[model samples]
Target chain A: MASHTNENTELGKLKQKIAGLEKLEQQHKKVEAKLKTVNKQLQASENQLKAYNEQLRESEQKLNQQKEAAEQSREFAESIIDTIRQPLLVLDKNLRVITANQYFYKLFQVSPESTKGNLLYNLGKNQWDIPELKELLKKTLPEFSAVEDFEVEYQFETIGHKIMLLNARELLQKQGKERLILLAIEDVTKSRIYKKELERLNKELEIKAEELQQILYITTHDLRSPLVNIQGFTKEMEASLNDLKKLLEKMQIHPAEEKSLNTIMDEEIPEAIHYITSSTTKMDNLLKGLLSLSRLGRQKLTFRKLDMNRLMQQVLDDFEFEIGKNQVNIEVGNLPDCMGDDLQINQLFSNLIGNSLKFLKPEVPGEIVISGGRVENGCRFVVKDNGIGIPREYQEKIFGLFEKLDPKKPGIGLGMNVVKQVVEKHNGSIEMESELGKGMKFSIFIPD
Target chain B: MKKELKIILAEDDEGHASLIKRNLKRAGLMNEIIHFKDGQETLDFLFQGKKDKDEIKNVASLLLLDIKMPRVDGIDVLRKVKQDEFLKKMPVVMITTTDDPREIDKCHELGCSNYITKPIDYDKFVAAIRQLGLFLLIVEVPDLNNMI
Candidate 1:
């Protein structure tokens, strides 16, 4: 019986050992499934990590490109500021120069390094330290919204004294956190001097016009009274001669004396009367011409829009009879419209064109061209004629009142003077170019 | 029958007055004409201190006035004559060398019978005055004898 118990105990111990080994195998299988799951999760994590690193690299490249574009835009803005021609400067609220344009440096004759970061008044050995500018920066800048046209006449070391118009405005920067001043300077010395000179010349011209008016008034009244007396007595002399001749005829003189008296009455007396009448007529005509010339200054002018083409045609038609008799060819080109007195312009053109027809070579047909062209500050009218031109020496003298080049040409010599008066009254200029036997050209310039 | 009228001529210029008298004679108006050298002399002859003076007191007369006279002008003479009840009946002819339209209008504004512009040409002047001389014979005028 003792031997049987011992064998049972051994069998139990052996079964227990086998059961423990089975438990160890189940634990090992559970651990292997967990390890498989952990390995799959780790592989997924590695793929996600690679994707995250690639996204970070793309973001960095975009940031670098945006930085470069912002840098390029800043350079473009700076270049645009440098291109301004006027002397422009930017200053901080304390009046220290922040930035300046290229013109500022060149105008002040200072380098950019010397200009920037320096006080505006202290720049260039304190040349800009003017009282007006000091008043502007000290009081006007803070009170007014802007400082405009503050004139500062300052003398510089390099350039002479200059009149500058300084304009300034307060500008806000960085969302109103900081304030800046934008100042612009312009030089107007030359224009100011020119305006003063023009005013002086205008005063002189007014005085000259007044003096001419006084002279004209005296000539019109004082010179005409004696002429009238001489004209009236001439008629009386003719009447007296007629009565004497009748009385002598009735007296019954001798044949020899009668023949002598007939010669005196018929030839000598008539010839003397003819010469006197002709001379008086010429004197009367000259006086009348002067009267009319002076009257032009006092006459009221009616200004209206006139078509030069139509006016030329009308003037040409008025002279149609003379033109046909002389076989003169008149051509009119495109003419500009102008504002002027119709009567005066008509007279002007008639005198010029009539001279063209009258002064033509005896056998040659006259040709005249009336045209208008553009000038620099105004319009130009050209009257060209292929006729007997005036001599060069007489060109200027022809404009004088009663100045006749050819005494036998049947003109009172006042036409050219009238033309000059009309042109000068309209503030225009006339130039004549001609040779003795060649063609003549009259160029007139009138402002728009 | 209408009595002949006397002519009162006031002229400042001697030559102009002589030419006018010759032309009036040539036109064949047979009337007595008195001449005054200046405007003051003319006013005295027409309206002397005594209103009734010999030939001019009772007879009807035509006044030929020249403008631009010394001391008193034709316009002033016309004003004075028209204001007088007795002399207003007398016909007045204003003759002058002034051809200004304003002066002609002014003369018409005054009670003048005719405004004649003396022509600068001798022939035209003679013709103008001859027309006036012929007009004097035909036109009826108020008598100064009946005005009082």
Candidate 2:
């Protein structure tokens, strides 16, 4: 029994060894499969890595070429800007000169070598040494977008004197900072001096304007009071005379029958009445015109396009009674239109025509003709009267206040004055041509 | 038919005032003459729907008004009067040097009785006064008691 057991144990050991061999074989196969799969993946990864490396090399080459192109463009643009005739400066973020025009180098009295790539403040030149300029530039940094045109006068140890304007602006940005700045310098010393002179003149003009205003006020006020008194007294005296004459008429007992009454009425009564009436009328007109002038001086004038046809018709209507009484003939031709104040222009017409009727030639019968038409950029108006024409000396004088051509004719000198003031107010000019015996003609040109 | 004479005088200039008064007197106008200076003063004297003041009770025969005056102008005064019940009847004669046609039209629109541009001739003016004075003599003076 012991020999059989020993033999079985040995067989068992052999069997176990067989099993172990089988297990080893299976493990080897599994490991071989894993190695095959891993080798295949490794080959694929190697191919991908080679392709990626090639692409990266191409990208790097393109990047290098782009960088080179950018650098070349920057240099070319800088050279182009620096070639300008005007003094120009290109500064980088650090206020260092990236490029400067030839004119700038000459103007600043700085050598090109020293100015290149140097900080502007450190140039050791008149403009660079200026403390004010430095302070202004430093304070105005980055946000400094205003175009300064003020004159800057620089005097230095080396250069005699120079005047310039510093005009600068932020040109470009890069890397979250100002990349470039452009500055232009212009010389305006003479113009600055001229502006200062202009300022001085403006001050003088203001003073003169004030003086004129005060004078006008004083004159209007003083003259108005006296003129009022004169007008009052004249009317009172005339009225008293009229009352006496009327009293004589009512009584009908004083030697004047029909013929006698006719003689008195025609000769003495009419003559006296004419004197008193004309004188008072003239004075009244003067005062009223003066008042109007004063009002004009005091108020702001409003002007607009005035239809001449409408304005003249109305003015002529006002003269209906006077025209009828004087037996005067007025023929109005085609009137030109213009922009003007209605009231003032109407006054102008009335005064001119009224003047014509007043200065009548003896026994010739008064007649007036108004004619005009449009011309280039304006309209022309002519007033021709068949009355005693004005003398050359009196023509100019006629426009003056209280100036009259004929003292014998009862009129205040205000008629022509009104005409002139109104015409000028309308932005027009007036010219008068007259013969002492024939008549007077006035031409007025008003711009449209 | 003769209309009653009642007159209003609006004048700011002292000389204008006296001249007007004297001429009215020579015209032998016994009708009441109510006078005021500035336009505002004249307006104040006439407006606010109040009954005519005792001096203006006759309804004013004629208005001899000047256009340029301190405070308010004659044009303003005339405008106010024409808009009123009693004062509009009075003939408003613009007796100033300004013969502005617009002023005449405005006066006419506002119911002015007439507009007379003050002429520079003293004698002619007296004659104008004489004519108006003759009208006054012919016109019956409105009795204040009978006026509305």
Best by lDDT: 1
Give the fraction of native contacts in model 1. 0.07
Interface RMSD of 2: 5.1
Give model 1's docking category.
Answer: incorrect
**lDDT by residue for model 1 (A36-146), tens:** 999999988988998998988998999899899989998887788788778888988888999998888887888989888999889988887788887887789989848
TM-scores of chain A, one for each prediction: 0.52, 0.51
Second chain TM-score for model 1? 0.93
- Candidate-wise lDDT, in order: 0.81, 0.72
Model 2 lDDT, residue B97, Cα: 49
lDDT of 2 by residue, A6-108 (tens): 9999999999999999999999999999999999999999999999999999999999999999999988977876776578887876779887887887766
Q: Residue A116, candidate 2: how far off, in angstroms?
A: 9.1
**Chain B TM-score in each of the candidates:** 0.93, 0.75
Off by over 4 Å in 1: A1-208, A252-272, A305-346, A349-400, A423-448, B1-14, B17-148
